[model samples]
Target: MSDTQGKDGLAAATGRFDAALARLDQSLVELTNRVQRIKRIEVDTQRLVQERARLATELDKTSARAKRLDDSAHDVSRRLVVAMETVRAVLAKTE
Candidate 1:
């Protein structure tokens, strides 16, 4: 080939290479951004999971306390009924 043709060919090849490099750099930047977003999402998910566990534990304790209170109320009601019956019986005897 002539020298001018060779120079033109080299210049075309260099332009194509530069374009490809630019595309590669752009892709790398996009990939890095995506990875950072994924990391943030992972951290948020972990935080939520921890919060859920804490709430579950709190719920369990509350349920246990409620059950204890309910049992105590039933016991008190039973005693009150017995006392009322006893008082009625005593009044009847007096009469």
Candidate 2:
């Protein structure tokens, strides 16, 4: 081949190589950005899981307190009923 033709062929090959390298760089940048986004999502999901666990603990504590209150209320109601019955008996005896 003539020297001129050889030079033109080398230039065309170099241009194609540069274009391929540019496309590869762009793809790498996009892949890096996607990995960053996935990491952020993972962090957000962990935070949400921690929040849900804390709320569940709080709910369990509230439930236990409510149960104690209900038991105390039931005891007080029973005592009141017994006192009323005693007062009625005393009144009947006095009469």
Candidate 3:
């Protein structure tokens, strides 16, 4: 090949190499961004799982308290009925 032709071929090859390098850099940037997004989603999913567990514990405690309250109310109602009967018996004896 002539000197000019050799120089021209080398320049063309260098241009192609530079273009390929630029495309590789752009792909790397995109891949990095996608990985970061996935990490953020994972963190968010873990947070939601923890929150659900906490809420379930809270609901269990509240249900236990309500059951105790219901039992106490039933006991009070029974006592009230006994007292009313006693009052009625005493009034009948007096009459």
List TM-score per model, in order.
0.91, 0.85, 0.80
Candidate 3: count the clashes: 0
**Sort order, TM-score high to low:** 1, 2, 3
Better-scoring candidate (TM-score), 1 or 3: 1
Using TM-score as the measure, which candidate wins?
1
Over 1-95, each residue of candidate 2 has an lDDT whose tens digit, in order, gives 99999999999999999999999999999999999999999999999999999999999999999999999999999999999999999999999
What are the runs in model 2 whose C-alpha is more than 4 Å off? none
lDDT of 3 by residue, 1-94 (tens): 9999999999999999999999999999999999999999999999999999999999999999999999999999999999999999999999
**Alpha-carbon deviation at 47 in model 3, angstroms:** 1.2
Of models 1 and 3, which has the larger lDDT? 1
The pairs that clash in candidate 2 are: none
Candidate 1, TM-score vs. the true structure? 0.91
Model 3 stretches with alpha carbons more than 4 Å out? none
